[model samples]
Target: MTSAHPAPSNTVNAPGTLAAANEEFWSNSAETIFNEPWVLDFQAKMRAFLEKNIDWLGIVNDRTSATEGAEKKMLDYACGDGFLTRVYHPFFTKCIGIDIAAGMVKKYNEAAIELGLASEKMYAVKGDFSASVLELPKAEDVASTDLSRDEFFNFDFVGVALALHHMEDPETAIVKMVERLKSGGVFLAIDLLNSEGVSESKDEEGNGGNHHHHHQGGHSHGHGHGHSHGTTATGRSGPAGHTISHDHPAFSIELVKDMFDRAGLTDVDIIYSDWKLELPFVTDPGAKLLVARGRKQ
Candidate 1:
């Protein structure tokens, strides 16, 4: 099968990094990922797609402003600058962002506050979102990190966007995020449409849903602003897009649908749109937005 993000050679990148270094990669690259022009352009397109499909998404769309809501909540898992949560910010009473990268968490809150959103209105926390892996699904599986806190459970929705291909295990990641929802809460996710169709797009994603929210192009530090790496293997020296390479090559509708079904979610529906990504350093195929959602039941 053809790889979704296979880049033509003759490029500059850190070649020896492993998937374990993703946190450091994301931490170091957080500084500029938020404001980079190309990154902003990509996010704008994501916003447009979400807006265009608001009805299909089944989330709030009142544009009520972040300060007004105080009853419901949203979990922005792998939240990078809180894109999905930001779009639904006005409608939800409280929104919490969870990420593996501390810097990404900081950025999510900073951007919200800059837009006049108080910390209580919308906040982000740094946690190992890839938890619940080794241990069986138990009451205490999520107890180690802030993930176990009461404020973390029972959500109106939990949304992940554009970062699934960066996860080490997208399937397990789904199980973890789904456990955080209330009995009837919905799980929303977005990923690339995989230009090669189901068979070619069958490859999994990288670390987990990811901090690659800074990624639309390739991996280095992130978004051309130095936000995607850790420091060599733990830090990036110059303007790079990510600190590491993506282990999970790409995503397809079949793979995601299977994940949702395995997670025991009902009414799963996966859809795609005409939007595409044409960033400077990105050579991966499939630029269209692929959206998927299912209820916890």
Candidate 2:
């Protein structure tokens, strides 16, 4: 427990859509973005929503109480410092997280260690689903950077939280994430709801990259736009004018359904979260989380 563990430097991206700038932005913003109080409150709301929708999320019972040796596994995409990891912690025997920033990966590992949890039980690897599958890291790189290994495949549950809006292509990202699920596994998306479709798929000036925001200290998950709270988004103190102005509208229900269907998933259903969400992650006003779920049959 006393051993000093360094963040793994081996980074892997699916190959195509992840922008290098955004990746670097997130890496730089990782330190303090997820640390705000409002951000934590927002997270609590999101957690409550997940717990409320436990059955729909495919878990046997809420992990908050009633301990069991559940062997289920989960893949949390854009897992800034392991929010979903904590959310699913009680239900899983193992959980692997993927993020575009190495700094974010370090934060996830640090949090696990702080909780006295073993790395094998809960840990995050630096990678993004938007990369190219063809260029998966070489075999030797699996231990450090490669995400295409046997362990990285076949998750019981897969989720991409608020960060979906940051991807270069949501459709392709969904497909790539679904490929990680085993048969009958569930693929989930928990993001901001914008029935009003995005004017364009461009993510200009919001947190920076991941879940940006104003002055949120909760997980301080600064997508560079940072946490769902805060003046600096997440918590990155970037350049003076480096703020994101929520120009990118959140995902619409129809858009999410179409993505699930196109990815060859079955039994797809979408629901709005009971939490009246807001922030930059930064979040938005009157924001509702659209929780869309599908099973890979």
- After superposition, the stretches of candidate 1 with alpha carbons farther than 4 Å from their true spots are 1-19, 61-70, 131-145, 198-247, 284-286
Candidate 1 per-residue C-alpha lDDT over 1-297 given as tens digits, one digit per residue, 9 for 90 to 100: 000122212233343232235457666667866667867777777687677767766665423533455467888987877777767776687888887777788788886887687789788876655533433224553422446779988887889876565555667788888988888777888765544432222343334231111111122222222122211111112333242234333454555666776677877766554444665544433444567878887
Candidate lDDT scores, in order, read 0.60, 0.60
- Report the backbone clash tally of model 1: 37
Measured on C-alpha atoms, candidate 2 has an lDDT of 0.60
| Candidate 2 error regions (>4 Å) | 1-18, 61-70, 132-134, 137-144, 195-249, 280-285
Per-candidate TM-score against the hidden true structure: 0.71, 0.71
Indicate the worst ten consecutive residues by lDDT in candidate 2: 1-10
**lDDT, residue 73, candidate 2:** 78
Q: What is the C-alpha RMSD of each candidate to the true structure, in Å?
A: 11.0, 11.2
